[model samples]
Target: MKRALVLFNQALRWHDNLLLSEHAYFDQLIAVVVLDPAEYLTEQYGIKRASAQRLQAQLKLLLDWQQQWQQKQLVLHLRIGDTTSCLLQLAQQYQAQSLIAAEPTAPEQYQQLKSTGLALRLYDINSLLQHQLRPDLASLPKSFSAFRKQREPELLVQRPLQLKFSGQFYGETKLALDTVSADFISRYHTPTAALLNEAAALERLTKFIWQQRAVLHYKQSRDALDGDWNSSLWCFYLANGSLSPCYAWQQVVDFEQQQMANESTYWIRFELLWREYFRWQMRQHNSAWFSKNAFRPPLDFSAPIPDKRFELWCKGQTGLPLVDANIQMLLHTGWMSNRGRQNVASYLIFELQQDWRLGAAFFEQHLLDYDCASNWCNWAYIAGVGNSGARQFNLIKQALTHDPHGDFVRHWLPEKTTAGALVHWPEAKVQLQDFWLPFLKQLKSKA
Candidate 1:
C-alpha cells in the first residue's frame, strides 16, 4: 500500500491546501505537525524567536485544525523536537514513500526541507502569485511600483483548491500525544480572540467586505491607531496560512464586480501586491535580508554596548507620547497599525539611532501577524538599507497629523498630564521637561 507523510507548517488550513488535495490519491496518508523547540529559546538578540503570546496564538491555530481533522476521522500528529528529525522518523515508522508540504519562502525553512533528502512534493499555495508565473529573481524589480506595473496587467490568482479524500487515511497513533503536555494542550483549548481557524478566517473576510462595508472606508481609517474595522485585520490569518492570499484576492475582485469599484477596492489589492513584493525580495536576497546592513554596503554603525536605549524603547518609556503609546499598544495587544509601525520604526532608526535589526527582532517576538519578510524588509526601508532607500518620518508631524486630538495617545498612555499637541512634545511641559529634554538635546547635538 502506498503511504505518504504530509507536513503542515504555516499552511494549516484544509481548504486551498495544494499539499493535501493533490496527494489525495495516496492509499494511506499521515499528517504531522512538529513544534520546533528552538523557536521558544532565546537567541543572541536577547529575545525568544517566538514569544509566549505568539506561541499561544499558534497553538490555538493548531488545536483548531486538529479538531476539524478529527471530525473527518483523520489524526494530525503533534510532535515537539527538531523538525527534520521528527518528520524523517515519522516517515520511517509510517513506511511512507514520500513527504509532501507547501513551498516555503523563508530561506531557513527551505534549507530544512532539503536537508531531509527524501522524495518530496512541494506546492506553492502560500502566495497569491504561483511560483511558476513569478518573475525571474535575477531580474525582479527593485521597487514596489515597478513590480506592480509589470505584474498588474497580467495578474492571475488561481481559484482555491477543494480537497476530497477517497482513500484510507491513518488513524490516531500511540505516539500522537506522547510528546506534548496535557497542560499545554488544555491551556489553549479554551476559547480566546487568538484562536482563528479557517472557518473564522472566512467569516471575517465576509464581514469586512460585505456586512459592514468597511472596505469602502479602509483607505481613510486604516491609519487609525486602534479600531476594529480600520484595516482588513486579515494579516493575522494570512500570516499563519489559515487564509489563502489567492482566496482573499478573489473575494476583493468579486466585491468590485457585484458591489462597487473604487480606489478603496483597488487599494486592497495594492496592499496584497506589496506583500508579494517583500516575499520575492526575501527570496532574492536570502541571508542578506537579515544582515546588519541588509542588501546595502556596510556602514560605521554599531549598537550601544548595553542597549539600554533599546530597552527603554521596548518598554514604552521613550518619553515621546505617540511612540510610547504605540509601543504600549503592541505590548498589551499583538497588533499595531501600519502608520504606527512606520513612525515607531523611524523613531528607533533615525531618532534613537539604534540598530534596525533589534527593533525588527522585538517585533518578531511580539507581533501576532508577523511575517519575517515584511517585518525585516520594512525596518530596512526605514533605515535606508533596503531597495527604496531611507524613509524618515518626523514624529512630531506624524503625531499631529494622524492623532490631532491626541485621543490615541491618551488611550494608550494615560499618565501624561499634557493635552493636545503638548502630549507629543513632553519636553514642552514643565513637569515632564526633564523627561524628554535630554533626547531633544541629543538630537540637536547630532544635527
Candidate 2:
C-alpha cells in the first residue's frame, strides 16, 4: 500500500494545502475539509451569530470541485463537532503518514492544528510575500502607500510554481454528499470547473482588473462605489487562497509591461501588500487583534450584542445607502466587493457605534473570502481598534466621497432621495417601478 498522504484545510478550494495536493503528488491521497460547527453556532460572545454565509460559500466551492474532479480522492469530512480532533481522527483513519497544510491564520486554531503530530508540512501561501516581507512590516503600515514604499521595491513577484503533488489517488474517500449538509452544498454556485479550479483564480487575477476595465483609474473611481471593476475583487480569491498574491503581482507586472500604468494599478498591488502586513500582525498579536483592549486599550467587547441594531444592519436597513446596498449584495450573494465592505464595516462599527466584532461576525457569516486575519484586523483598523493605532472611516463622509451621485445608494435603497443632497451622483431617476420590484424578478430568474 502506498503511504497515504492526506491534505486538510477549512475550505479546500485551492487554499495553499489543496494547491499542493492538486499536483496529485501523493499515493492514495486523502483530501479532507473539516468544518467546526461551533464557529457558526457560537455567538459573538453573545453578539448574535456570525452569518451562516461563510459555510454556504464553502459548500458552494466544494460542490463545484466535486463536479470537476469526481475521480479525485476528496473526502469531504464535515465534522459537526470536535473539528480539530476530527481532523486527527481522519488522518489516522487513512493511516496518513504525512499531513500537509497551510500555516494557520487564526491563533487558537493554529495551536489546535499544531497539536497533531502526523508529519505536518505547513507552507507559506498564508503570507502574500511569504516570510521575506513581514519582518519589515512588523510595524504594519499606517497607510497603504507607506507600506508599499517599504516593501514594493523588493517584491520580485516570484514566478508561479507548478509544484506537483504526484502519485496514486482515490483509495480513501470515507464520506459522501448524502452524509454531509445538503443545504450547505447548495449555497455555492459557479457554472464551470474553470470557476472551481486554480486556473479560475489565475484567470480572475488577470481578467478582473487589468484586462477589461483596469483599476488604472481606480484612485478616483474606487470611491465611486456603485460601479463595477472599480476595485480588484482580488480580496475574495486571496482570502480563500483561491488566488495567489504573487501570481496577481505577476499579472500586475504583465500589465505594467503591456498596458497602461497608474495609481489604480499600483494601488491594487498596494492592497496586496497591506494584506501581507495584516497577516504578519496576526502572527504578532494573535487573539488580541479581535479584542477591544486590542491596542492596549479600554473597551469591553464581551458586552451584550444589541439584537435590533445587528438585525437592521445585517438585513440592510441601516438607512444608509452604501451600507444597505453592500449588506444586501453580501446577503444575496456570498460575497461583497472591497468597496462595499469598507463602507459597510465603517457604518457597523463607527456610525452605529456597535461592536466591531458584531460586524466581523456578520462578514464572516457571508464573505466567501472571509479571511480571519484580514477581515477582523481591518474592522479593528477602521473602527480605530487595531494594533496600528487609531484609524477611523467616517460613514457620511465616505458616502459623499464614494457615491457622490448616490447611484450605489439608490441601487440598494430605491425609495428615499435627498434631491439637493447628492448633487454629483445625479442620474435622473427614471420613475422606476416601485424600486427593485422588477429587479427582484430578474434576480430570481438568474438564480
Clash count for each candidate, listed in order shown: 0, 10
- Model 1 C-alpha lDDT per residue in residues 94-204, reported as the tens digit of each score: 888787888777777877777788788887787777865767889999998999999998887776766765355585656565445445566544466478668888999
- For model 2, state the Cα shift of residue 312 in Å: 3.3
Model 2, 114-214: lDDT tens digits are 67766666666656576554454356565556766777787775666655554444533445433334444443333431233455676666666657756
* Segments in model 1 whose C-alpha atoms lie over 4 Å from true places: 166-168, 180-193, 297-306, 427-447
Residue-level error in angstroms, candidate 2, position 96: 2.3
Best by TM-score: 1
